[model samples]
Target: MTVYVDNARIPARVGRTSGRWSHLTADTVDELNAFAAELGLLPGWFQTCKRKCHSTLPCVHWHYDVTDKYRSAAIELGAQPIDIREMGALTTARRAALSARPKGPTP
Candidate 1:
């Protein structure tokens, strides 16, 4: 299923809840929440925390955590749903890119 969150497309309908919230970096959190509010999602849907990676902090992510039951509601406001398989392809490409990086010319 494809659901549009804040005008951006995302995946839905796999496990427990049909829809999965996409990652929203700190820079985009404010905008995402505002959009969520417009859609009528509860504040509990929002999540905030800095995950450590390479000693760098990439902005936090915000999610709506809505399920298939609530998907229609989101759609009413303009949330597009996407296929989960397609989403994995993106992750696979990112992983391949990360693995292709050079490591100081192994001797």
Candidate 2:
């Protein structure tokens, strides 16, 4: 699975970090997490659910929000740079995969 980093440089502050941030995502969650480890990213830093993670919803978005430093490192580490359209396609595919996941007993 190819890892992709978007060109989004939105200004933000996470914890003590303050800088433009980009998204580091992959074609699969396993690959994303594995690559994140290579980038020295903590498992806690991984973002999947947008709102409450405890919510009984399929978390389709799996990515690491990388600051400028991490973004640069990601690019240097061979993460493919992608555009907004590419991101949309990726998200759509992820959502579809989520929909296809085998479901358990409905509460």
Candidate 3:
């Protein structure tokens, strides 16, 4: 299970917040959550795409929007830092693979 971070320069200027931020994603939600947990991010910080909010819609991906400091820490900890273009393709493939899986029986 690998975690990925986009190489897009920090977009700190666009947001009202004070620091740069980056998206942290993984091949699976469990992997993503675990990595975020290692980063000391709370469970509440986990975020999924809008589609993931509804059962009928395809779940795109799960991620954590992390600050620049955390971004550096993530990379140091073995997260693959990738180009923004590559990041898009990676996420697209991850989403497709995730959505194609068969669901277990509902409780």
- Give the top-scoring candidate (TM-score): 2
lDDT of 3: 0.78
| Candidate 2 regions with alpha-carbon error over 4 angstroms | 50-57, 100-107
Candidate 1, residues 10-44, lDDT tens digits: the string is: 56654565554453211245655676677676677
Whole-model Cα lDDT per candidate?
A: 0.49, 0.84, 0.78
TM-score of 3: 0.75
What's the CA error at residue 16 for candidate 3, in Å? Answer: 8.5
Ranking by lDDT: 2, 3, 1
In model 1, the worst 10-residue window by lDDT is 53-62
Regions more than 4 Å wrong, model 1 = 1-27, 48-50, 53-55, 59-61, 85-107
lDDT of 1 at 49: 47
Worst 10 residues of 3 by lDDT: 52-61
lDDT tens digits by residue: candidate 2, 10-91: 8998889899988899988889999999999999989877674333556766789998899889889989999857887898
Provide the TM-score for each candidate, comma-separated: 0.45, 0.81, 0.75
Q: Report the Cα lDDT for residue 106, model 1.
A: 75
After superposing candidate 3 on the true structure, give the runs of residues whose Cα lies further than 4 Å from its correct spot: 13-17, 52-57, 98-107
